[model samples]
Target: MSSRIREQLLSLLLEQGDAFTSGEEISRRLQCSRTAIWKQIEELRKEGYQVEARPKKGYRLVHRPDRVAPEELKPHLRSQRFGWSIQYHSQVLSTQLIAHDWARKGANEGSLVLTEEQTKGKGRMDRAWHSPPHSGIWMSLILRPTITLAQAPQLTLMAAVALTRALRRETGLDIRIKWPNDLLINGRKFCGILTETRGEQDQVQYVVLGMGINVNTLEDFLPDELMKVATSLAIEGGRTYHRVTLIASILQSLEEFYDAYLKQGFEPVRILWEEYAETIGREVRTETSQGTIAGMAVGLDPSGALLIRHQDHLQPVYSADID
Candidate 1:
């Protein structure tokens, strides 16, 4: 269904409150035939909306689903740019790959690639990310920032800060950023972010930020290896969360931080990241491709690299898993 007609139908149902609105009444209000109204109602049902239709009572809106479809998010989204253009998929290989392809084809900045499940989702260092159907938030955002290639890494920290703040506000959980782009709650991982950029020399053409969050994933759905280290909002909070609301909140937070970083600098993002960082001033073991380095996590550099005070000098780490 077109967003306009869906919006009109939802508005009519919402305006009616507990009362039922007949198909003829909706047809006249939306300026469509009764058949069209029925079809739209079926579409709404397919999207997880509960619409009750009786012989005489007509149609009544019962419940709204927690899906992350465009129509579901349009009514809740508050951003001016981010999430304005969304490519929603029920299942895909990876949102990062699709977003990168769209970015290369000149897709607009702030365009979002969202999926309910990913067959081959990956994280930093090419690790498979478990994305169960209708249980997690697996998305990638296409950004055409004018920042230099060197400054692009800060976007990962920016996303971490945004996701941290959004989850804190929504779930009231004690969320913390673990290095480059991981969110932990009570020392268990719940979110991971991977950022990919394509550029040359000092200029950056575009960046695709992939985010996978375990929202309503149950314990049985997780792999045996991940069961100990990973967790979900439902497990932590003892309830399921509405994915649409969380997505809208994260998009708004991202747009706010992205604009701030562009106009001001990385200082604002750095400060916010530090406030929510879980690695600072702790004994950490960073495992990079070269080898493992164990030291005290001092802080972050201006460019968002993890700074580890390894004995004599402070070493800057660009990529690694903190243990």
Candidate 2:
């Protein structure tokens, strides 16, 4: 079945909402033949949608799988750009790798690549990200902004602020931004954002922003070391959450903040980021490629670098591990 017809069929079933629609009515509504409708219904069943067919009443939607699909998310999305066009996968090596290729092939500005399981998930410095199957949010967004290359780092901070705000409102948990990219809960890490740009010397062609969030993973299932340093919303909030809903909230929030950051400049987003930042005004030890620097975390610079107040000089760190 064609992608267009597949989506329309699911949409119609969902709209009917427990009530069965006759085959004649569906064919007339979608302008397709009864044979085509039957094929598409079978396709939906293969994709995990439970559809019931009866002699008199044609089809009824019974159950929608827990997996996140664009058809399932369209009704919940409020964003104009983000998540409008999506590439969803059950498993992949990394969504970032696919997103980069999609960007090069003329994918939309806000095209998103999402995966339920990532076998080789990546973190900062190529560190392994513990992404269990069907337990976390492993996704990437392709962004083609008009900002200069020098201003790209601010996007990471802006995303951190957007996700932090949305997760707090959705989960009702205390989540804080830890320096450049990580999100913390009670001093334990819960989320990480990675931003990579593909461009020339003076221009930014596009950016692939990858986000990994531990939503419903249980704490006891994690490794010993990860249990000490990592946590999830289910663990912190004492309950599980629907990943589809969380994805919609995140996309909506990021698109809102991203539009504002572009029109109003980084100052506005910076202010909001500082509001939920746990790194500011605290003593920190950062391990940069240059060396390890331990000092007081003062504020962020214009380019989104973390500023540290040492002996007498203030230093800006572009990338580091805050220990």
lDDT of each: 0.90, 0.90
TM-score of 1: 0.94
Candidate 2 lDDT, 1-323, residue by residue in tens = 47688888888998999899999999999999999999988888998889999999899999987777777777778888899999999999999999999999999899999888999999888999988888889999999988888998899999999999899999999999997899999999989999999888878899999999998899787778898889999999999888888999999999999999989889988788888999999999977777789899888877788889977789998877786
Looking at candidate 1, what is the lDDT of residue 265? 92
Pairs that collide in candidate 2 are none
Residues 77-170, candidate 1: write the lDDT tens digits.
Answer: 9999999899999899999999998998999999999998999999988989999899999999999899899888899999999999999999
Candidate 2 all-Cα RMSD: 1.8
List TM-score per model, in order: 0.94, 0.93
Model 2 residue 34 lDDT score: 95
